[model samples]
Target: MNKSNFLIVALVVILGAVLSSVFIVDEREKVLVLRFGAVKSVKDEPGLAFKLPWPDTVVRYDDRILSLDVEPLEVTPLDDRRLVVDAFARYRISDVEQFREATGAGGEQAIAVASRRLDSILRSQTREVLGSVSSNDILSSDRAALMLRIRNGAIQNARAVGLEVIDVRLKRTDLPTDNLGATFERMRAEREREATDERARGNEAAQRVRAQADRTVVELTSEARREAEVVRGEADAERNAIFAESYGRDVEFFEFYRSLNAYRSALQAGNSSMVLSPDSDFFNYLKSSGGISAQ
Candidate 1:
């Protein structure tokens, strides 16, 4: 070969070797340099990285916090109420070297393996923590504390997989669909019972008020009638006293006045007619100024 051709071939081989030995670590990723299936170094900082060429390799993993949505799981609380729980977690790769070792895989497969194992850990912790509390606690505002407990538990187990569990949260906690209808029915029945009790109490109060009002009305009417009778009797007694005084003052005049009242009452009828002799005793007042008999 010519010297010029050989020099050009050597320069090309050198350039390829340089390119093959170099890699980049992005700010969003962590890199592992492996030689013959063994980790040589880890590059987490964003910049140029180097590795031995041929049979040496580079593996990259995401450095950002990752989110995982857990599949809905059924749990029985301390109250023995079964609930369908949907949860999610936030995590990150804390140590890439440990992660690669624990996962026993390289490239993207490591992330998948770690995720499966972490999911199992998280689910177990979730069931354990949630089962220790009642359904009311799970459904109440205290759920934040429960979630913290779950995250803490998962954090402990996650270290084995080189993952840092940042947070765990319950997206939804609800009665199982099979039991939801029964629970609603029970609640409705309870509400109805309360309403019935209230209605009964109200009715009892209304009856009491009505009975009291009726009794008051009867008492008032009876008192008013008694007063009227007493007043009528007093008026009758006063009239009789005046008539007795008139009789004592003039006996003949009182007799004449009485006769005149009798005559008026007997003649008060419409179309009245009477049959009497001219000398009847009833005509004594007409015959004389006094009520004495006219001889």
Candidate 2:
């Protein structure tokens, strides 16, 4: 509780404060110790560490996984359609010195640079490949393959910054409003014209079919009439032949029979009567109604 006790407590506090500057590396992190703004020790592992107080500093880096989303790049499709594509990139720092130099300003600055690099690569690849693709192919599929190439390109560019890009993925790809309108209009017009042509062709074909059907109907009707006339004439010819043959069998009897048939057909109805010779078959028919008594 005296002056010596006060000095002792003050020294202990200063020593504790200086000891507080010691570096504590975690198992999940890597650290680089700098003294007087110069490289001291690059601790790649975890556990306890030491550093000069105030004049010495420690910079810890997570060698763990980190994700960065690059800004969207507007690219032209092979068919000249503009597409806005967004991509995400994943990376990790593998080398401490390389990372330190690469991330001069910080990981954030390094990420920004890498993002730019990715954007450039994506834009280049899209412009080169997608610009020459057909509209059908572009509409049907992703022609650019921006993510894969961009990831590979970013890793190559990021090597100087000590970055290990794990993967690159295209998050979104969409047509720009202007390009969308134009493309849609073109497609719609194409489809509409096709529909119109199809309708016209169908109508023409229908007309042809109707004309052919009508022709068939007329031909069938004419053929039926001709067949009916032929059949009637054949039947009439047969009847005449039978009559002729019967007459040829008995000439006089046929004459008498004909005379009687004529009288019956020509006779007036009611009280009207016919005046014929007594020898005629008319009188014979009038006398004998039982067909000459069959004797």
Candidate 3:
């Protein structure tokens, strides 16, 4: 080969070697330099990185936060209530060397393996933490506290796989279909008991009011009857006194007046027939023109 051609080929080989040795690390990724299947160095910052060509290799891990949705799982709480729970988790790669070692793969393959491990950890922790509490706690605002416990537990287990758990959350919680009917029946029975107690109390109050009203009516009616009897006695006494005064003034005229009154009373009935002697004193006023008795 000519010297010029040999020089050109040498430059080309050098340029290819330089290009192959250079790599990029972005803000979202963490990189590891492995020497013959052994981790040699880690690069986390965003910049250019370099390594030997051929024998040295680079592996990447996503440093950004990642999400995983857990499938619905059945859990039995302290109260023995069976609940179906759906949950999710947020995480990130915190240790690249450990991650690569644990997964035995890099990049997308490592991510897939890590995700499965994370999901399993979350499921185990969820079951453990939630099972220690009652269903009421699971359904209440205190659920935030429970989720924290779950996250902490998952973080401890996930360190082996180089994962840092950010947070764990329960997306949905519900009674299992097998327990729903019984739960609803119990709730219905409780409400019915409350309603029955309320009705009984209302009926009792009504009876009390009615009794008081009846007592008030009886007292008022008795007082009214007593007053009427007293008024009637006073009126009778006054009328008798007037009659006595009239008799003292003129005996004959008083007797004639009384006779006229008796005749009016006896004859006032419509279509009434009297069977009495013609000399009856009751007829004295009718027989005499001057209203005097004809005895």
Candidate 4:
């Protein structure tokens, strides 16, 4: 080859080698430098990273948390009730060296392999943990506690694949389609029975209140009437005593006052008139300005 051509070829080869030797590690990624398919160095921090060119290759795996959706699994709880559960897990690549060895794959392929392995672990653990509990526990407010147990179990198993399991959660747990109608009917019946009981209790309370109010009204009215009768009796006794005292003081004057009151009552302004003889005793006071003897 000519000197000029040889120089150009050397420059091209040098440029290629420099470009291949250096790579950037993003903040969200972890890198592995492999020599002949064996791990040589790990770059976990962001910035420039170097490796020998040609035979050496760089493989990157995401360092950020990742989510894996598990396939729906059917579990029979301790109550022997079957449920279809959908779950997911959060994980991150914690140990890249071990991950490489466990997955036996590089780059994005490692993530796929790791996911499959971790999925198996999560499924097995999920079934084992959930199977020991009752369906009520799985479906109630105790779900947070059950999820924690699931996460703990998954952690131990996921470590084998160099993944740190952050959490395991049940997205949904549902009765089988065949059981839905029956379950809903039972729930409706239970709610209606409870409502009936509440209404019965309310009616009983209202009756008690009404009866108490009625008794109170009767007692108050009777008490008020008794007090009024007592006052009237006292007034009658006082009036009779007063009449006796006035009769003892002056007999004629008492008779004259009583006759005057009689005249006022019998001659009140109304469509009422009395027919009497002119010599009647009632006219004695009118005949003479004095009394009956004077007439």
Each prediction's RMSD over C-alphas, in Å, is 7.8, 8.4, 7.1, 8.5
lDDT against the true structure, per candidate, is 0.88, 0.70, 0.90, 0.89
Q: How would the candidate models be sorted by lDDT, starting from the highest?
A: 3, 4, 1, 2
Q: Measured by TM-score, how close is model 1 to the native structure?
A: 0.63
Candidate 2 residue lDDT tens string, 1-295: 9999999999998988778777678886778888876778888767788776777777777767777766776766665657776667677776667766654534345446545654554456545544665545545557345456556666676676676778876677777776777878977988999999999999999999999999999999999999999999999999889889989998767767787777778876884665768777556656665555442
> Which residue runs of candidate 3 sit more than 4 Å off their true CA positions?
186-295
Model 4 worst lDDT run, 10 consecutive residues: 286-295
lDDT of 4 by residue, 1-295 (tens): 9999999999999999998999999999999999999999999989998999879999899899999999988898997778899999999989988888888776778778878988888889889989999888998865998889889988987887789999889999999899888877866887899999999999999999999999999999999999999999999999999999999999998988888898988988893499988788887788898677675
Itemize residue pairs with steric clashes in candidate 1. none
TM-score of each: 0.63, 0.52, 0.64, 0.61
Residue 197 lDDT in model 3?
Answer: 100
> How many clashing residue pairs appear in each of the predictions shown?
0, 2, 0, 0
Task: Point out where model 1 deviates above 4 Å.
Answer: 185-295
Model 1 scores a C-alpha lDDT of 0.88
- Arranged by TM-score with the best first, the candidates are 3, 1, 4, 2
Task: Name the Cα RMSD for model 1.
Answer: 7.8
Q: Name the lDDT value of residue 258 in candidate 1.
A: 89
Best by lDDT: 3
